[model samples]
Target: MASQTDDTDRITVRLAGREHRDWTTYRIDSHLITPADAWQVTLGIPADALPDTVKPWAAVDVCLGQDVVLTGRIDRIEREVAKGTNALAISGRDGAAVMVDCSAPIFTRRKATLTEVVDLAVRPLGVSQVRVEATGAKEKVEIEPGMTAWDALAQACEANGCWAWFEPDGTLVVGGPDYTAAPVATLVMRQSGQGNNVLSLAVTEDVSGRYSEVTVLGQAHGTETTDGQHNIKHQETDADVPGYRPLILVAGDCDGAAEAKRRAQKTLMDSRLEGFTITARVRGHRVSESGKPWTPGQRIQVVSEPHGLDATYFLMARTFLGGRDKGSITELTLKEDGVWLPELAKISGGKGKGKAASAGKVVELS
Candidate 1:
């Protein structure tokens, strides 16, 4: 279990099924946009305390108190010995690291389901368990010879309006966030120190990759039996972009106008993911109210008078820093709203209907 005080939280690492604690410093970074979470630790122990013989590539489980935060293999280990000091450092990434580094299975299947495609991408990588929460009609799936496992899974998931990620226990999950879920915690920043729980908060607004409009042009190839030629295209506009900046994309996989529109919409969502970001730094690795470790994809309520923010934000990423000078700290990366919808705007009703702009707006911290 993680030992927690009012100020800081403790961490433990189980290497080859043996638990070890008392690290001098550690940093665990987890995020939703990235492929995998990363972790590293430094141990300041005496020469005689280095009794364990475990080397690099050993299976490891990192826990924040009782919750397993990361499960993977150690990637590197470094040892330093001074005249009177000895230090050891270990670093690794979560199970998704393997999927990001290794190539997926190269095959083509006609009328394949999401589960079948996910199986092809993960099974060869030794990821046995898979939970696909989203469903879609069967479609033809083709993977190239050198595509990364993460890329293969992403392509499959995006077609179904879902995303793929690994759980703490190494289970591959294919699903989308439930936007209706309640906020887990409320973060407050007051002028007086009495009611303030946040150490520091920062917001960043970027529009480099963001576009005012996106157009996807695609051509449907004729089958062997037929020689029909068709041109398919779709366009989406971003209200957030004030200028006339436009982006044009060519999608070879688009089958029709609908597919092309989805592709264009996804581009807007990607822009929103990079447009605005909020960073919150707080003490302890866990939330004070829930007593649970900070996690990605959870909604958090923000109440900052200085920033004039009294809205809910989504937690896109969080980093846990232990053994710092002040105490254990959690740095949260937040988006304007939780979850990145392909439209980047709320859908009102059915197909061909206009989308309503999102309630949240990008705020300039300056």
Candidate 2:
């Protein structure tokens, strides 16, 4: 029940983080200011009048002698409350209101802990791990196990006596820290091979858009030789032409080729493509009396080209038993051309006796 006045008087209030600070006579009166109005006045004080540790949006404890009175965050200056009067609102911890007269009381501001600030700002968005860091403030925080980085940060902020605000767009507004301190995105990739020499790759995205995090999950291409005598070469092509898109690749053997193909196709369809492609390759050998048949290792490659295009190609070798000598290579390429026919024809023409490759439209994979 503090009032407004023109004469300087000492007043105190409890801040959000349970820290207490003293204010000297700058102005005091019998008029009650809304929470919003109190915030405005607090911001109007001269920078030199407040402590050096005081910062914008800080949760300060106000007091009248030894007794704490109110708690709220410091907002900007309130310009036009009334004639010859300067006022600002303080948003209380429990959503209450406490107004202050800027011209009378000499107020003191103090710093709050980092934990306090994060607790007020962070909210769960279905993410698994969350990490929060302060850009400038110093504090040690212990994050609980199995908690997302966001939640851990909130707990830390609360413990440190800081104020955190959640923006309508989902970004966090923290006291004494910048937005860059928040974690952006996390990416997870899992790969497994089946009996049919087919490999499966799974990528998961777990983060909100407010963090401005971009993730690209794709396969890495490399050649490995076993026993030094077997030479395996595999090719991967995309049916669609060039464009910018994120791609993921999987290669290995599977029990059911159809099921593996279905899963891969579904992943491609479900993924958001800015222009990307995925390719897989499979190789196996057939032994004969003339010589040991060559079995090439499976390969999957995802390539992101310069012009914002993504392409993927898969190659599978067909083996012939009993010296029938029918070994052929099949190539499937996904390209991003306006017309698919030209690229398909080019891939088909590249076939040879040592290798037989085929190219088809993206629709074929669908």
Candidate 3:
């Protein structure tokens, strides 16, 4: 058993039927707003700490006291030989990572509901259970030729405004954010170095993800006659954004009018709120208002005086780092509304980019 305290949570590592307790360092990275609820863990120890009979692909389990927090197979092992003693490092992600490497069957012209398509794609992978929330319940989906399982799942998630991720126990869950739910708790962060719950704080905004207008174009089947004139037809939709910079988006090759319109509306609606992130670190393992240890994907209210920001935000991602030297700290990456949508830029490149040069241009993924 591992030790547990009010301000600290102990983690136990088990690999290939052996328990590892002398780890020199460890870190857990969990993405709460991603399609896979992806989590990556790394553990390091002296080389001699390894059991005599150890090999790659061994079953690895991470636990907090008696509760299993993560279960997956180890995919990487590294060794370092220094002047004195060597060190070993191991890392891997959860089961959902496997789906990224696997492929799904291609359906040339099959029509099925969104739920049915998701079931057919993931069922073969031994995904214990699949639950798609309200938004995608009655939607019809088509599986095109040569679509990977991951693509199929992403398609459904994108259209329905939902995210897909596996539970720690390997259950596949697909759902939208519960905006109506109550927040976990109010975390008061003061700028003063003393008597502040937050050790550090950062706020950022990106204009690339914001758009002032969205234009969608879809393919129209067959020709139509208007006033005795034969004409090729097409579907189009447009959305005007308010307050955001005048960036225009042009999306083409949509399946149909409805699909084109939905895509345009969703892309604009989800992007209305600019990308604003608040990153902070808090000491100890904070228990949320929900009575559980703080984790990502939960809503929380934050009061930061120096920043003049007081609002409810979604805990999008978190990293837990703890050791004998630094005790424990929970690092949080938050989104204003906790919406699981894509961002314009993965990172803020340097500060030298000319603002005038980037104005009124659609930001495309490279």
Q: TM-score: which candidate is best?
A: 1
- Cα lDDT tens digits, model 3, 1-366, are 123333226666666566654345667667754534333334455555567545665666765555556666666777877787476767766666666667766556576666876768778766667776545356555667677777777776666555677656656777755544566777777656555667788877665676655655545444355222122223222233336354334443344556655566566646643455778887765554444666666766667777676666667777767754556687888775523443221222211122112211223321
Per-candidate TM-score against the hidden true structure: 0.87, 0.17, 0.76
Candidate 2: list runs displaced more than 4 Å: 1-9, 13-50, 77-366
**Candidate numbers, best TM-score first, in rank order:** 1, 3, 2
Using lDDT as the measure, which candidate wins? 1
Residue 343 in model 2: lDDT: 16
Whole-model Cα lDDT per candidate? 0.73, 0.28, 0.58
Better of 2 and 3 by TM-score: 3
Instruction: List the RMSD of every prediction in angstroms.
Output: 5.2, 29.2, 7.9
- The digit string of per-residue lDDT tens for model 2 on 243-362 reads 444343343322133324433443343231223333322221212222222211111223322122122232222121111132222222222221121211222211111101121223
